[model samples]
Target: MINIANTKTSSTEQKNTPMAFLELAFRPFFLCASFFSIISLLLWGAMLNGSFTADVYGGALWWHKHEMLFGFVSAIIVGFLLTAVQNWTGVRSLNGKGLLGLFILWLLGRVLFLMPVNLSPWFIILVDITFLPLAAAALAYPIIQVKLWRNLMFIPILLIMTLINIVMHYSIVSQSPQLMNNASTAMVLLVTLIMTIMGGRVFPMFTANGTQTPRVNAVGWLEKVVIITTLVALIISFNIIDLPTEFKAGIYFIAAVAHAARAFRWKVWVTLKTPLVWSLHFSYWCIAIGLLLFGVAELSATVSQSQAVHLLTVGAMGTMILSMISRVSLGHTGRAIVASKLMTFAFITIILSTIFRVFGSYFLTDYSQVINTAIVFWVIAYGCFVYIYLPILTKAKPGY
Candidate 1:
């Protein structure tokens, strides 16, 4: 029901400054995510062996996941919502030093946390957790001013995610057991919620727009079904570390069915032509399939969590982010919505990456291979964005 086109470009800001940094949303965050991702993964890979040294952080692996989920992905989320919220509410989003300050906080958190806990972890925590709330506040202001109720929901979700990251960081430092479990569960749920919200909003709209056909919502009941099953999957996951095999198996089976049913009604067959569109459709399908495969593992002890999370991470999250970033960049910069040949190549690269990552999980039967291959594809997907869209992200819109 959101009229996306109507809400875009309402309050215009000048883009003629000597600095062209504020031209669009993807500029700072995409740049940051790209550089940080490469460095972060390399750091995590090193830390896995005990070769990595840091002053304050206890577990390197924990720091790795924390950075990936909270640090890296969080940057992308901020860039995205800032732009999207501006579009949805017809308000000018953050720019100038405010935007740069947010990026710097993220950068400093990375640097500070990696070193010894010198003065206090409090300083690092404050910087690490501040970005999301600030982003939420920026987005929420305009939406609330216009009495936009639906978009308002995203603010609290961001807040909760930020809080979860806060708790997770504290738990890592203090060694609180429950905090770790809760944060992991919360991150998975947040990922699922992201899949649903963006999937629902963009999939049908993209399909209809690209195809010049009437729009199609997935299914009336599927929305509720998706949320319930995602939660069910998370709840069952917690029990896996402790509960009996049979108990976990039963719950996972239910979760799998719910996930598959939720995704099936979307009619992915019709979306194949638009790589951007189909990639998302396929990605959501991966979420369902991953859940289903996970259920199979629980019930029959076939595939492992490592395998299933690969499917979700590489298949669902990887492709979705690639598709969204590609589309959002063109649309936001006042460019035509058509993908260039090179951009189209980027799309294919991501799909291949998803396929390789998922297959590495299933076929190679090596956990490291799966992670390695998935990281390759992730780099391919995001690297392609940096390669092709850098100009769009960095330059002012034509009229600006």
Candidate 2:
């Protein structure tokens, strides 16, 4: 297990704050992300049931989607990258006051978006969108110092995501609902692309390590096909280029087959006995299944686009991120990388939640009940995360 304390931190920071949690990137950010997951779901459920609404400038549904994607998920991405970049380059990323400042900026954006205060759309954009580029800047200096050109790919993705967010806000400003929807859809595809890249890097490696098996290898041609086809599908999905649905479906179907082929080569079945390992594999499978459904939905009138998207969002992205944050938190905090019983249960519950959210619409006549059931499962999953890790994240790292 990798320990955060083993990372190169100076003695000045070691003694600067009694709150050792602020001394590293993952501590506060992961804690906040997990907490926000719970709160956001509950509020979204209430919005679905007509109990209450958010105070944001966009409609409640848009606010919910944006916050869940950008507000909550982005925190995990930044936290993981900040922590990982240090290990990659042997240089400090963010620590002490700098991390705290970033966290505060994130909190400010969330508050401005959720509260009833009358903030300008441009103001929200300014506060909310600053976090990603700033995070990229923090990582860039170290990566450049090490002359790691490949690692620089993440910066462009961050900038693109930031651009999408700005475009989303501009859509709100102009009251163009379709534009807002398109921008949000683009953001989702962009995140999925990032997940595809990261999952390709880590899933097979983790499976090899955990299962004591030979490293699962990627097929060179398959990787290239997936990247090219997924980019095409994303462009078509963006709907900004005015592509035909038939063309989008064809590209999406090809992307789906390629992703499934690659994932199958990873031998995920061997990971079943290990919750931590299997969760990663299972979530990857979710992406493959989601993409297949996404393509079919474009071609078939019977399948709902919402279901396919949820399969990716809730089943794949949510489950993968939750498992990762849990695993990484445990490893970095000087604990065993093994998942606890509660954590295992959390993983299972989230997978079940994904099933309900993604497929329940087809099974049941009333969609609201499906949403309610899925929300309950989501709460349980994230609640377990907060229950298990809240104290660990706040306290000093072991031997600090």
Top-scoring candidate (lDDT): 2
TM-score of each: 0.86, 0.95
Cα lDDT tens digits, model 2, 86-130, are 887777678888889999999888888876466666777789989
lDDT of each: 0.69, 0.83
Off by over 4 Å in 1: 1-12, 15-18, 46-58, 117-119, 176-182, 234-252, 355-362, 365-367
In model 1, state the lDDT of residue 394.
81
What is the Cα-based TM-score of model 1?
A: 0.86
Task: For model 2, state the Cα shift of residue 13 in Å.
Answer: 4.8
